[model samples]
Target: MERVTGVGGVFFKSKEPAALAAWYRDHLGLELEPGSEAVSVFRWSEPGTTTWSAFPEDTQYLGRAESRAMFNYRVKNLDRMLAQLRADAVFVDDRVEISKFGRFGWAIDPEGNRFELWEPADGL
Candidate 1:
């Protein structure tokens, strides 16, 4: 019955990860979690936080003034939750996409920040 269960993924723009990964490794004491240099994955734990959403510099999907990250919340039912949000007068994106992974949608918070909503398919 929860609106959101957990985070789905965290993404960031990492061009030339072979060189950039070393910086995160050396400075932040982070190590490669699963992916290789071509694409690095950093798995850390935080309260109600998770995902892999990297936006371009010109983009403002996460928040205004470049907040540096975006979060994708895991919902039980995308259609219902979106309807709830709509009834509550929250701004929900009109488009929804479905894939083998899940059904996805977007919503803007009161703070004018954009975030993602995902209803994972069975066993996903």
Candidate 2:
């Protein structure tokens, strides 16, 4: 089984999400969409392209620690991939979540960076 197909998304934290997003838009020319709070969704030009976004500095979504960022890796089979990681003595998180979007899992790297694995929903 393929371990990681590609990058799904890149997430990081910011003290002022709105100001930071505006900076990206103005300086980087990212066409940001308006959403609740300071969230922005940058759709992929290709069907299965990747996503990139920045989170709030105080957000604990990455982990309970002060992780600067988290990378979401696209996986072929999330369950199987996680199983393989565990079999190889990797510290895979026990929590597996499924939603309309797709399945999600987490694993810690040797450096202790908490990263996410995503198996996208069909037709996504």
Candidate 3:
């Protein structure tokens, strides 16, 4: 059996498609194709955390309502990325927390989906 390699792209619906595409392009440097079948592709790495967790079915989160929250990209320079997002006036929830695992922060897209930005603990 041929095993699946990795995620190719992430497709989602955006209310303000153009604006959102521009936001992703300007901030995250993701080249978003503006349309209903828009996808933002990026070169991702292995997750820092070994054990991946999932939210309950009855969750009240924005992303939860829209099918499933697909990807959580890991970053080595999270602070710098966060700074860039801040400069763009993007809506970032300032509830950053450092746990035994790694550092975590949240950023909501124009469509109100909460995406996680993680910086994993060293020597994992």
Please give the clash total of every predicted structure, in order.
Answer: 9, 0, 0
Provide the global lDDT of candidate 3 against the true structure: 0.56
- After superposing candidate 3 on the true structure, give the runs of residues whose Cα lies further than 4 Å from its correct spot: 1-52, 60-67
* Worst window of 10 by summed lDDT in candidate 3: 1-10
What is candidate 1's CA lDDT for residue 39?
A: 34
Provide the RMSD of all predictions against the true structure, rounded to 1 decimal. 4.5, 1.9, 14.1
lDDT of each: 0.68, 0.82, 0.56
Model 3: which residue pairs collide? none
TM-score to native of every candidate shown: 0.66, 0.88, 0.52
Per-residue CA lDDT of model 3 for 37-102, tens digit only, reads 235544346532332223344445425565465445566756776777888888877778799757
Residue 25 displacement (Å), model 1: 5.9
lDDT of 1 by residue, 1-124 (tens): 3478877776554445456666766886655556555233434453332433334555555556655556788898999999999999999989998998789999888877678898977755
For candidate 2, lDDT tens digit of each residue in 1-120?
557987888888889877887888788786666564444555666656566577888898898568978999989899999999999899999999999869999999998999999999
